[model samples]
Target: MMNSLKHITCAFALAALLALPQFAPAAEAADQPQRPILSVDGRGTANTEPDMATVAVGITTYATDAGKAQNDNAWVAGEIQKAIAQLGIADKDIQTRNYSFRPTYRQDKGHENEINGYTVDNTVIVTVRDVKLTGKVIDAALSHGANEISSLDFSASNTQGVRKEALRSAVNDARDKANVIASALGKKIVGVQNVSESTGYLETRRFAGNMMLAMAKDVETPVAPGSLSLSANVHIDFILSD
Candidate 1:
């Protein structure tokens, strides 16, 4: 009888242990305190004068003979290249972009497309380091048989430096605004909890160099690079203490 009573007691203890509830993640999260966080976004922009200019210049020619068309294009392209070399621009700055010969088409009164002649085009992309002489380069090319101008883009030579400056400015801006908000709410910043950045750059737009000459200028084509802007944005989370 004594042995049976001890066995029963042991069984009862084991059953009590199995009936106890498990402590889970749901219960742990309820015990945690909510942290006071201040969130803000800040933006900064920096503008500077561009120092480099890139222009696409080319010559297009048409002739009944395919060989003649290519020859004419090469001759005119050669003259333009010589003029560019005389301007003290480095040989590496001139890069041949496109050279092609295709059949020219004409639509007759019957609405049928007819091949009238062959057209040849030769183009070069030039990177001019001196922004001030952008107008002179355009003038030189036009005077020497560069008839098709596709695009002109201006930008700074040292873009990395400008980008860093913009990011630093963004961080400073975030700190300043956070300080203002915290002071207004009767709180102080205990420390920085998180930081994130959103960076952006406005791609430089292309300008038509040929159209600029239509402005009736007796001198070299006048070009104004204006200014380029480098921008950055940052989001900061600061822990608040009151």
Candidate 2:
């Protein structure tokens, strides 16, 4: 009986310990203070002379027969390619962008457009290493029967390097603005809380009315590739203190 009583008492003690209520970790205090912050956006632009120029030359030919049209276009395109090569452009820089053989249609009285002849257009995009050679390169292609300038653009070769400079300027601009605002409010900026950057791009302008050079005489074509603008935007949050 004594042994039985001792075992029963031990089991009751173990059951009492297991029945205690459990509690979860406490969450953040509800009355905590939020740090005062100043949010600002800054924009900066850096301009650099472009080192490269992109131009597209197109050869268009028309003939009654499709084969003749293709042949003429191919011959002119080959000549234009040779001309560009003579202008010191690398073979890799010359890329074929478009080739199309389509039937030309003429409007007939009270009828659907009638097929008059076959037309073939072959175009190539060329990147000029030197901006000064843009005019000469176009003139060379024109002399070889390239009649169309589809697209033209100029851009800085070292865009990333230029962009880095722009980003630094933007950050500096943000800090300056923050300092001005903080001084006005009689508060001082203590620390940086967060920073973010937007997607930046290079802005290049097109060469306007440049195709008219094909009609001019032996004069060297004048091309002015204006400065290229590299821009960046930054958003910053800074802590404010009294």
Candidate 3:
């Protein structure tokens, strides 16, 4: 009877040990492997004519009297606002960028001296929704006492759509590159494990410095917003299988 009781106890202990395995932690029991991953970089580009432009127009008024300078600046700013409205630009699209009153300095002999004048600068940024009207808007601003054309930038009105398309193209390019590399190594692509993307636009414009702004007086300010290129670069890690 003692021998039979010991045998039954041993059998129950063995069964309990076997049942414990069913409750084991998944993270501890999962099969994991570390291996070299294939990384490929791909780039994609898409170009479209810019649909919108941002123009900075301002009046720089200088006079010996501070009150006169302030009054003149206000007058010119009003004219610019009126001109912008006449072109169908809504009030919301026109924004005041800068308003300042500062003393002017001039060269007196070999030293810099403070001139007897106060300069008032009033600037506004306007978004021109139509690309074809860029030149006309510039001309109108200049005629309306806008002495300083600070900057002109071209951009797309619907940037999100362009960015999405560029990203899709970049993904396709990365997959193609991975396929080529895998094909050369006699391995097939199993799956894409990870992907990252970097995207933006490059702006190249005609505005440079004070001299360029001065040169606008002689020319018709021929602005050629040829084509804006939106680009995307992607890095992908793809798992391969034999």
| lDDT values for all models | 0.83, 0.84, 0.81
User: Cα deviation of 45 in candidate 3 (Å)?
Assistant: 1.9
Model 1 deviation from native, Cα RMSD in Å: 5.5
Models, CA RMSD each: 5.5, 5.3, 4.3
How should the candidates be ordered by lDDT, best one leading? 2, 1, 3
Candidate 1, residue 45: the lDDT equals: 83
Question: What is the lDDT for 97 in model 3?
Answer: 76
Worst ten in a row by lDDT for model 1? 209-218
Q: How accurate is candidate 1 locally (lDDT)?
A: 0.83
TM-score of each: 0.80, 0.80, 0.78
lDDT of 3: 0.81
TM-score of 2: 0.80
**lDDT (10s digit) by residue, model 2, range 1-242:** 99999999999998878765332222344355667899999988877889999988878999988899999998898899999899899999998877889998877775557788999988889999998899898888878898777667898878887888899999999999999999999999999999999747888767635544443344666678888888899999999994
- Candidate 2 clashing pairs? none
TM-score of 3: 0.78
